[model samples]
Target: MVTPGPTSPMSPAAWAGRRDARNLRAPVKKSRRPRLRRKQPLQPLNTSPLPGDSGVCDLFESPPSSGSDGADSPAARGCSHAPGAAQQLAQLDLQTFRDYGQSCYAFCKAREGHFHPRESLALQPQVTAESRCKLLSWLIPVHRQFGLSFESLCLTVNTLDRFLITTPVAADCFQLLGVTSLLIACKQVEVHPPRVKQLLALCCGAFSRQQLCNLECIVLHKLHFSLGAPTISFFLEHFTHARVEARQAEVSEALEAQALARGVAELSLADYAFTSYTPSLLAICCLALADRMLQLPRPMDLSLGGHPEEALQDCLGKLQLLVAINGTSLTHMLPLQIREKCCLSPSLK
Candidate 1:
């Protein structure tokens, strides 16, 4: 008897809203389209008087209603229609970011390529599986707890690996730099950038903004400012969406099975399973595996106990192979301490 997790009913109105994507409940007249609305910046949540209140503006501002003076606004006069203004601004910011990143990459490349090519240019004299495991052991828990998506974490790890493969910072500085690079990658990928202070706070003040900036420079110099590594979020999203859609025809239990399958797929992505496959292909495989597993007589629940145990075990196997391929250690993926606490032994009964 599997206890199902909370599920939100797919309401007709919600389904229709997803399809049309229009907010017609509060009707807007055609006259509003032509007039320009003033864009208001969101006020801070702290500014609000009510408890539990968050002051945030609507994603898109409503346009002003058109009257006899409709054409007189700045928007109507083409002030807001600059073709490349947004692009130009974005490019300028990217240039600045790239400049810092390239500087870091170049520094590392120069050190590894020229200064000490044969001197074990690895940030450490040696990075054994054990040491790698120890590092990831610390990193993974922190990352997951912070809600750092799997894909972003993968990119961070891969980026560090690529940089290390080329240029070796000292072992003492490696973790500091790795975390900084991860922070930068998160900022690049996530909608919200975790602030420097927030990260420093997490590290118990072991590192500072200046230190992070300096290390970031070195990493950028080594990698030539390349931040093009792939992430797992893309695959996770696609696979989850497809699984949800495919299971729509099934009974509620079947849907739960498939949804659980999707969760297993996501957890399986914990290791570098996504590295070999293109993002799209990885997405497909994850979905396929999830679908197959869910269609069983005793469907794998992906929950903490009972039938979900099998699905969880399956995910562990796949993740292990992926970690091996990427030359990463399993300390972060699954630690002995965690296994003991969860009562998950090698036998996995």
Candidate 2:
């Protein structure tokens, strides 16, 4: 739901470093659903529509159905029938898809590449260099399709990547999951969520919105609503503020560092590389990349420009940790575990 919306966007000058307008991380989970808390004064900068805001589609509108189409869900098709039966059905589906391709989505896949799987973090590439070729194959064309405002698309990709970090999806299902996640994200962020039928019509003629919605629900359930995070735009704000306040060598260094950080994050999209990592890790990667680019050998010293060193350091440290955890051993960790030492697994629980 959207409200009248705030006329004034926060200016970068107001909060240097950590509290900079651009650096404001999107509130995850409950914070995203707006409400007035007596303890927290309303910041004029908070402009996003509340989850229950008016003028948006009513929540009561029929949630997409799973049985509208004759075809069963990927789960049902994958397991309810026999092994060979699923493969046979998949072949039939693919053939049908070939006959009914829609131009809505531009198909992307590298002609040559490999998927490197680590022991605990099974499907992630160890380094961007090793994964660049394949990642470019998917990212280049896709980025072309979704331009600068593509942060939402990136969010969707990040969601899929994060889900893949702990959940073991089959290699074959990767495209399906990625596309479906995009569909889900579009529904959430876009003024008009594309019809589920449009996506299916592009992939294969036989499917329906209901089946896609079911798959989306399955994916959402698996991810446990952890996909949303403050985006690069948030970082850009803090960086802008830092640049505004710095002078002389410090100013040059800060700008260089911020640019470098952004470059690193841009590189992340190549392989959906940031997916396995935590939010904190992703933030670190952005900073570290910037740090290295600025030729700063040590962690950023926010005090260089009289910025709130404590808050800046705290935020940066947390962000860097997120990036480090993403591609490393920590990629295997989940948000919260539940019942019987089980993960509250997405599907097989």
Candidate 3:
């Protein structure tokens, strides 16, 4: 059921074409820009820590009462708010992690659906599919700017969607929610999370530090502190390693294909349609399509993932449509060598 893969000649390009596109969230910086908040950095919440627990603050606090002071907020501290104690993970070193990688993948896959939201926007009275896309477009560039890993991006979207599913949000507060989700996701996987102020600065200071801190607590509470979700990034890396170990494809070829697949996966993040598919399924389909696109020799054994063929085909077909639509952006996102050789498969056209 898969459509013909777009044969993108890869090259030095990486997310090149899209950065210039107007950020739905860039802070106004010129005379044409405003020192004031309008759309970029719109206001969201206010924060103050709950009483006690001085070693670390509560990951969440009840909304401030009319009688309370707002002194313990992230703004009050002048630093990135560390995710409260609840989000901390036990130390698992790289060698130890690799030794138990498969078991870890199993644990993550089992919990993916528990953390994932089905038709998340169906609950939103204000946010729409288009709005979600716009928000993600801006987020992609922001994440790249921050030099965050792809795993963080996946978890960020998961946190965003799941929180939206459980809460009713205002259109005005949606942008704040987006950054708040990113912050929470960063805490999960990033060693040096972006400062609350840095994120707000990108939004052009439309959102205050307090509002972001407040929302962080709300998201953590709403999701019940379940942050370790499976991601396409994890599965993509997993399948790529398996391909190399099986000696099904040359390391160079597999790496190139994996790079292209990552761009595809990033595009998928903005797309709500792909959300219902599990990370493992999407990762396999992406690997399959990448092989076809890069035309890698001795392609990966898809059976290793153990997903049904029909499900693979269905996801592959939709991903083809997505690649076709974003063919130019995808090309620009690839390295220069591949960019020159790459062409969208005729079938996609």
Candidate 4:
């Protein structure tokens, strides 16, 4: 055995063997050791209570009853909590809202002349405006009977006009066309649409279920599946809402005004003379007329430059004449279904 002396040169193999023997004889050290934990920054405690944090707060409060005198209550003033309340609250700047309204009005006003029923009538002379009005008048009772929304009613009329403009049909098929349009509108707008059986019954069996379905296909195809036209009622709702906000009108008063506006709009629907007015202009005129009837302190501001003042005045005069000729009272001129549903009698003189 060769004994390796300190400071003496040794073969590389022998040195390696010696190092391995020493490593094996020594105890193996573990690589793992307890890691030092990092400290986290502490959060500050909230000191103030948020709005509606108390159990007594009526955050999601209901509107005050019509009979109640609590018109100043938050809910009655349209301050009730709703879904996305926080988001709406964040955007509750009045000036900002008014600006948005003006912009929306401008946009809709720009597109107004494009959607007049007169344009449609020009193409299809066979479908006279008088016949159109008669059909729309009939739709009111049907709309009420089925409990369809105002949106559905307006959409139905829009579909009717668009389809009539593109395709010419015989006078006998007008009812069928109206029924199919109503079906399409209801399906698009209602959560649960009126069934085919209900529609057939409404038509008094004038149209077979197959005929109605086929007509629907024809209308849909003619319109290219575009049923998203903005109707007078759509703009009317927004204008009415804005009027309420602008005037800070009470809920009952607002409701009454809107009901009157809707009645006027429906009356316009029955007259071909109103067809020359754009939906926006017609809506503006309706709001203006309703405000006048109510004799409210604040008049609606509907003056967009280039608005046909002469035409609006002419239409308003016609509407007044219709109301006068139809019945002895304002409520009488309004469809009975609208009067009862909107509770218009209590507010109107």
Q: Best TM-score goes to which candidate?
A: 3
Considering TM-score, which of the candidate structures 1 and 4 is the better prediction for this target?
A: 4
Model 4 lowest lDDT segment of ten = 79-88
Off by over 4 Å in 2: 1-120, 123-140, 148-150, 192-210, 245-263, 271-349
* Model 4: residues with Cα > 4 Å off, grouped in runs: 1-104, 123-126, 248-251, 304-306, 328-349
Candidate 4: residue pairs that collide: none
lDDT of all predictions, in order shown?
0.47, 0.44, 0.77, 0.68
Q: Which candidate number maximizes lDDT? A: 3
lDDT of 1 by residue, 182-230 (tens): 7867877766656778777777788778999887887788777767653
Each model's TM-score, in the order given? 0.44, 0.39, 0.71, 0.66
Q: What is the lDDT of residue 164 in candidate 2?
A: 60
Candidate achieving higher TM-score, 1 or 3: 3
Q: Candidate 4, residues 1-349: lDDT per residue as tens digits?
A: 9997779779999999999988786668989988988588777554344476673434445433444364334333333111122332333345555668778767766765555556667777578888888888898667765656677887887788878779888998998898888999988888778898888888788879899898889888988897766688767766766766766565445555666777777777767677666777777777776766666667677663346678777766776666555434446545344455433222232
- Per-residue alpha-carbon lDDT of candidate 2 for residues 1-349, written as tens digits (9 for 90 to 100): 8879667865676546546666777878755667767997767643444476573544345333433353343334322211122332222223333454222111211110111122323554442333433533454344334322344555665555556665766544555665687776666665555566655655555455676667788878877765544455333434334333432225434444444454445445543334433332343446544553334545454443233446455545544443453433112211111111211112111
TM-score of candidate 3 versus the correct structure, residues matched by position: 0.71
Per-residue lDDT over 1-349 for candidate 3, one digit per residue giving the tens place of the 0 to 100 score: 9899888764545445455464447687766654665667657555566567672444445533433254335343222111122211211123444587678778877887776688999979999989999999999878876767778889999899999899999999999999999999999898789999889998888889999999999989989998888889888877766666566776566666776788899899999898889888888888888777876657667788888988988999999999999998887666665666556667667
Positional deviation of 50 in candidate 4, in angstroms? 10
